[model samples]
Target: MGLKWTDSLEIALDLIEEHPDVDPKQLHFPQLMQWVIALERFDDDPKHCGERILEAIQLCWMDEAD
Candidate 1:
Protein backbone atom coordinates (compact mmCIF):
# COMPACT_ATOMS: atom_id res chain seq x y z
CA MET A 1 0.00 0.00 0.00
CA GLY A 2 1.05 3.58 -0.60
CA LEU A 3 1.72 6.14 2.07
CA LYS A 4 -1.26 7.24 4.10
CA TRP A 5 -2.15 10.63 5.59
CA THR A 6 -1.02 9.41 8.98
CA ASP A 7 2.50 8.76 7.67
CA SER A 8 3.64 12.16 8.76
CA LEU A 9 7.37 11.37 9.08
CA GLU A 10 7.60 9.67 5.72
CA ILE A 11 5.55 12.38 4.09
CA ALA A 12 7.65 15.05 5.71
CA LEU A 13 10.81 13.37 4.50
CA ASP A 14 9.44 13.25 1.01
CA LEU A 15 8.49 16.90 1.19
CA ILE A 16 11.94 17.82 2.43
CA GLU A 17 13.59 15.99 -0.43
CA GLU A 18 11.18 17.25 -3.07
CA HIS A 19 11.18 20.84 -1.89
CA PRO A 20 14.62 21.45 -0.52
CA ASP A 21 14.24 25.22 -0.75
CA VAL A 22 10.74 25.44 0.67
CA ASP A 23 10.32 26.53 4.25
CA PRO A 24 7.56 24.49 5.87
CA LYS A 25 6.73 27.39 8.18
CA GLN A 26 5.68 29.44 5.16
CA LEU A 27 3.71 26.60 3.62
CA HIS A 28 -0.07 26.80 3.43
CA PHE A 29 -2.39 23.81 3.62
CA PRO A 30 -3.73 23.90 0.05
CA GLN A 31 -0.27 23.88 -1.47
CA LEU A 32 0.90 21.36 1.04
CA MET A 33 -2.03 19.08 0.13
CA GLN A 34 -1.26 19.42 -3.55
CA TRP A 35 2.38 18.62 -2.98
CA VAL A 36 1.53 15.62 -0.86
CA ILE A 37 -0.81 14.28 -3.52
CA ALA A 38 1.86 14.77 -6.13
CA LEU A 39 4.20 12.46 -4.26
CA GLU A 40 4.57 9.15 -6.06
CA ARG A 41 4.12 7.04 -2.94
CA PHE A 42 1.12 8.90 -1.60
CA ASP A 43 -2.25 7.24 -2.06
CA ASP A 44 -4.44 8.54 0.73
CA ASP A 45 -7.95 9.91 0.30
CA PRO A 46 -7.94 13.66 -0.19
CA LYS A 47 -11.05 14.09 1.89
CA HIS A 48 -9.22 12.66 4.88
CA CYS A 49 -7.00 15.73 5.13
CA GLY A 50 -7.66 18.28 7.86
CA GLU A 51 -6.01 21.19 9.66
CA ARG A 52 -4.57 18.98 12.39
CA ILE A 53 -3.10 16.51 9.93
CA LEU A 54 -1.60 19.28 7.86
CA GLU A 55 -0.17 20.82 10.99
CA ALA A 56 1.42 17.54 11.91
CA ILE A 57 2.94 17.20 8.45
CA GLN A 58 4.22 20.75 8.63
CA LEU A 59 5.75 20.18 12.03
CA CYS A 60 7.41 17.00 10.88
CA TRP A 61 8.74 18.71 7.79
CA MET A 62 10.14 21.50 9.94
CA ASP A 63 11.80 18.98 12.19
CA GLU A 64 13.31 17.21 9.21
CA ALA A 65 14.71 20.49 7.97
CA ASP A 66 16.35 21.26 11.27
Candidate 2:
Protein backbone atom coordinates (compact mmCIF):
# COMPACT_ATOMS: atom_id res chain seq x y z
CA MET A 1 0.00 0.00 0.00
CA GLY A 2 0.99 3.62 -0.54
CA LEU A 3 2.02 5.94 2.27
CA LYS A 4 -0.61 7.66 4.38
CA TRP A 5 -0.76 11.09 5.97
CA THR A 6 0.49 9.56 9.19
CA ASP A 7 3.69 8.54 7.45
CA SER A 8 5.30 11.84 8.17
CA LEU A 9 8.96 10.75 8.24
CA GLU A 10 8.69 8.67 5.11
CA ILE A 11 6.91 11.45 3.28
CA ALA A 12 9.43 13.96 4.51
CA LEU A 13 12.31 11.80 3.32
CA ASP A 14 10.70 11.50 -0.08
CA LEU A 15 10.14 15.22 -0.28
CA ILE A 16 13.73 15.86 0.72
CA GLU A 17 15.00 13.59 -2.02
CA GLU A 18 12.60 14.96 -4.62
CA HIS A 19 13.06 18.62 -3.74
CA PRO A 20 16.56 18.92 -2.44
CA ASP A 21 16.75 22.60 -3.28
CA VAL A 22 13.46 23.59 -1.71
CA ASP A 23 13.55 25.38 1.62
CA PRO A 24 10.96 23.83 3.87
CA LYS A 25 10.55 27.15 5.72
CA GLN A 26 9.56 28.90 2.51
CA LEU A 27 7.13 26.25 1.30
CA HIS A 28 3.55 27.47 1.15
CA PHE A 29 0.86 25.19 2.52
CA PRO A 30 -0.96 24.82 -0.79
CA GLN A 31 2.25 24.00 -2.60
CA LEU A 32 3.26 21.59 0.13
CA MET A 33 -0.08 19.83 -0.22
CA GLN A 34 0.36 19.59 -3.96
CA TRP A 35 3.85 18.12 -3.56
CA VAL A 36 2.65 15.65 -0.99
CA ILE A 37 -0.15 14.46 -3.23
CA ALA A 38 2.27 14.24 -6.12
CA LEU A 39 4.54 11.80 -4.31
CA GLU A 40 4.49 8.39 -5.98
CA ARG A 41 4.09 6.61 -2.67
CA PHE A 42 1.43 8.86 -1.32
CA ASP A 43 -2.13 7.54 -1.64
CA ASP A 44 -4.21 9.16 1.05
CA ASP A 45 -7.31 11.17 0.15
CA PRO A 46 -6.54 14.83 -0.39
CA LYS A 47 -9.63 15.68 1.62
CA HIS A 48 -8.03 13.96 4.61
CA CYS A 49 -5.32 16.61 4.85
CA GLY A 50 -5.46 19.56 7.23
CA GLU A 51 -3.29 22.34 8.61
CA ARG A 52 -2.04 20.23 11.50
CA ILE A 53 -1.04 17.39 9.21
CA LEU A 54 0.64 19.81 6.83
CA GLU A 55 2.50 21.37 9.71
CA ALA A 56 3.70 17.98 10.85
CA ILE A 57 4.89 17.14 7.38
CA GLN A 58 6.59 20.49 7.05
CA LEU A 59 8.32 20.08 10.37
CA CYS A 60 9.43 16.60 9.43
CA TRP A 61 10.76 17.89 6.13
CA MET A 62 12.63 20.63 7.87
CA ASP A 63 14.17 18.12 10.21
CA GLU A 64 15.24 15.93 7.34
CA ALA A 65 16.66 18.92 5.48
CA ASP A 66 18.91 19.61 8.40
TM-score of each: 0.97, 0.97
Model 1: per-residue Cα lDDT over 1-66, one tens digit each: 899999999999999989999999999999999999999999999999999999999999998899
User: What's model 2's overall lDDT?
Assistant: 0.95
lDDT of 2 by residue, 1-66 (tens): 999999999999999999999999999999999999999999999999999999999999998788
> Which regions of candidate 2 are displaced past 4 Å?
none
Global CA lDDT computed for model 1: 0.95
Question: Root-mean-square deviation of each candidate, in angstroms?
Answer: 0.5, 0.5
Error in Å for residue 55 of model 1: 0.3
- State the C-alpha lDDT per candidate: 0.95, 0.95
Residue 60 in candidate 2, Cα distance off native in Å: 0.5
